[model samples]
Target: PNSSKVQAYVLSRKMLDKIVLLASRAQLPLEAIIPEDDVWGDTAGELGNFLLLQRSARGHFRISAFVEHTIAFHRSIRSVTPPLTGVPSSELQMDSLSLELQRSIDYLSAQLRQVQLHQLKVCCDEE
Candidate 1:
């Protein structure tokens, strides 16, 4: 059940070091650095469920899933939403992206058991 399935996140060591270094360079007192995805989830009620997905001509995918109005799963991969080119690499990425998303949905359904997710709300990150 959901009780046994706890939300777990792993931060890359290099990313943390870079964040700390940037804070030091800017002379800013950093008490905590909350992930952008968490902020999106916490403030979702006001915006009616908003997820920021960064898309580019050649870019990676950073996605998250919310359960009970909070992030339950998050992942970043080397491929997602590749441009509409018929290139082999982009095609492979599209295939991988679909597989991963479907697998996640199935896992969530099995874990929650009762709750049904009607829609996955997401928006492109213009930044």
Candidate 2:
């Protein structure tokens, strides 16, 4: 029963754990690091599976896993190229990617707050 919805929920929980870890590293509370109204959605296709996590406001994060149907044949025909012998490049790219991902997470968390605020405003206006 490994349906797409279950997979998405698991992925969302994993992302939440990652956010908590990052928040701990920054000495911030987990609740403070994530917005309360964030939502997770998933779409599965023959080409790939996509996890769309978003807040109601302006931020979202997408993590995709390629479906075997799309890449299996290509990978089968691909040849591995040997790395050139030289001093390996610095870890800057890895670090930069990590930093960028953290920033995106933070931004999305903030958007979650905005989403809550918007909901409150709408409710108040209805009165």
What TM-score would candidate 2 get against the native? 0.24
Best by lDDT: 1
Candidate whose TM-score is highest: 1
**Pairs in clash, predicted candidate 1:** none
What residue runs in model 2 are displaced by over 4 Å at the alpha carbon? 1-89, 113-127
Report the C-alpha displacement of residue 122, candidate 1, in angstroms. Answer: 2.5
Candidate 2: residue 45 Cα off by (Å):
10
lDDT of 2 by residue, 1-127 (tens): 1123322213377887888888889998655432222211112333232222222222222221122212110011012111211446346633543464455445534533332111101101111
lDDT of 1: 0.62
Q: What lDDT score is found at residue 49 in candidate 2? A: 22
TM values, all candidates: 0.53, 0.24
In candidate 1, where is summed lDDT lowest over 10 consecutive residues? 48-57
Show the colliding residue pairs in model 2: none
**Model 2 residue 120 lDDT score:** 8
RMSD of each candidate?
Answer: 4.9, 18.8
